[model samples]
Target: MRTQVAIIGAGPAGLFLAHLLARAGVDAVVLERRTRDYVEGRVRAGVLEQGTVALMERLGLDARLRAEGLVHTGTNLAYDGEIFRIDMAALTGGSAVTVYGQQEVMRDLFDAAESRGVRIVFEAEDLRLDGLTGDRPSVAFTRNGVAQSLACDFVAACDGFHGVGRASIPADVLKVYERVYPFGWLGILAEVPPVNHELIYANHAHGFALASMRSPTRSRYYVQVGLDERIEDWSDERFWDEVETRLGPQASAGLVRGPSFEKSIAPLRSFVAEPMRYGRLFLAGDAAHIVPPTGAKGMNLAVSDVAMLAEALTLHYAERDASGLDGYSARALARVWKAERFSWWFTGLTHRFPDMDAFARRMQVAELAYIRGSKAAQTAIAENYVGLPMGFGGEPSNR
Candidate 1:
């Protein structure tokens, strides 16, 4: 197979990149190691930054999202049973986030791309990029026990953190910055109704708990705990009780138990890779950077990376210009680092450290109090929450 772009991985980043490139009259092929059903059903981030939603709308991929997504004007920050709502729209000039699962977004994009005749190969394994500096970079992979090669002008490594894309880069040329938190989130998806109108980020003595809803009929919640905790150790009753204790005393407005749909743990961390590109192969999304889920920036950042990449590739192919391509790494890393900082700030303020001394705990509380009391602090939080501007701060003209 031959194309202008060979996109590895069919996750949101890869799929969206292919879609955007196709609309720009670029031919691209996407390869995924997982089945279509698995990719579309995997649970991940749910919040969409305002810029992401706007980009989707411009790309004509927002019909279902607009109909099915739940929009929130603000989110509640709860501590010691007191709640403070940071009005995102008020602070960010009417820009607000929409609560829609990452899996759902993937489903929408995959379906739309397929309907538009985009090529996507699933269950393909052993993806390897070879001869990236040559005229035609080749992607070697196996599909249904048969090895095949895909020739392309360039390769976009949208495969995630554990994928081969990140490993393909030589270690000497890469500078990895990472910090893993001592705690991880024990996330659960329940069939019951949500406990609150909007997301409730609670900070309590026991730990941190997030009360978020996927839809009107489904609730998604998380509790901070040791990374090694087993799901079997916490019964349904115990989980609900812990949630109530952290959120507040049990009441009608409190969370009610329901059939658990999914339970898993995700370790919290902040990571970034300098210069998201090397030679003819470029890394985007989780392959380039990762952010803790506290600020709900992981999926959004991935989308942002691909959005920029698609534009860059379009410019390169349309105008025979390498300027956008040359500056792609720097432009993408700027937003990536900003998101990393924001996620780190939010995680540090909310999650308690095991070895935190009395003075440190007091300082954390004081910081939270200051954020609630100071309009400037709240505006800063709200601005990051809504999203930063897109398109590298210039007109959409090709660079």
Candidate 2:
């Protein structure tokens, strides 16, 4: 097979990149190691930053999202048995977030890609990239016992953190930075109306809890747990009890309890592999960086990364210009680091550290109080929560 670009992984990053490349008249093919069902059913982040929503709308993939997604102008922060609201829209001049599942986003992108005749090969195995430093790179994989080789001008590594993308790069060329937290989040999706109209982040002495929704009828909630915690030890009844206790009586009012249809424990980490591009191979989304879900920036960061990647690729093909492609790493990394900062900061503020001393706890309380009381502090929170403007190396946004 031959194409202008060979995209690895069919997750949001690769799929969106293919969609953008096609619209730009660049040919590309996507390869996924899992079946289509598995890819679309993976439950992940649900919050959509303002820029993410706008990008989907531009791609004509927001028909279902705009209809079904829950919009929030503000979010609540609970600590010391009290709830304080941050008016995101008011603070950020009408910027807000949308509650839309990552599964739904993939479904939409998949549907759009299929309808438009973009090639996606699922169930690919042992996917490998070759000659990334050369002008022409290629992807090799096996599908149903048949060996296939795809030649392309560029290779996009959107295969995620554990995928072959980063492993393919030489250790001497890639510098890795990672921080694995001592905790994880035990999350569940239940078929019940959400307890509140907006999302809430609670700071309890026990741990951190989050009250969020996938839709009006399907509530998604999470509580911080030790890294050693196991999902099998948690029962539906116990999960509900813990969630309610952490949220407090007032916030848990009208809390509807139901068996969770899906449950999982996700470890928290902040990881970034510097210089997202090496030769003709470019890493997008989770393949390049990861942030704790506290800031809700995982998928949003991926969308922004690919948007920059797509822009660079488009310029390369349309005008025979390689400037954007050359600067892709610096441009994408600029935004990736900012998101890491926000997620790290928010995680520290909300989560109870098991090893934290009295002084550290006191600082957490004081910071929460300051954010609740000060307009400037609230603005900083709202702006970062809703997302900062897309800036490429301090250049003014043309959007």
Best by lDDT: 2
For residues 62-166, what per-residue lDDT tens digits would candidate 2 score against the true structure? Answer: 999989999999999998888889999999899999999999999999888877768999999999899999987889899999999999999999999999998
In model 1, residue pairs whose N, Cα or C atoms come closer than 3 Å (at least 3 residues apart or on different chains), thus clashing, are none
- Model 1 agreement with the true structure over 309-369: per-residue lDDT tens digits: 9888988989999998998998888788888889999988888889988898888778889
After TM-score superposition, the amount by which residue 177's alpha carbon in candidate 2 deviates from its true location, in angstroms, is 0.9
Weakest 10 consecutive residues of candidate 1 by summed lDDT:
390-399
* Overall local distance difference test of candidate 2: 0.92
> In model 2, what is the error at residue 121, expressed in angstroms?
0.9
Model-by-model lDDT, in order? 0.86, 0.92
Give residue 391's error in model 1 in angstroms: 3.1
Q: What TM-score number comes out for model 1?
A: 0.97
Model 2 poorest 10 in a row by lDDT: 390-399
* Clash count in backbone of candidate 1: 0
Candidate 1's error at 397, in angstroms? Answer: 15
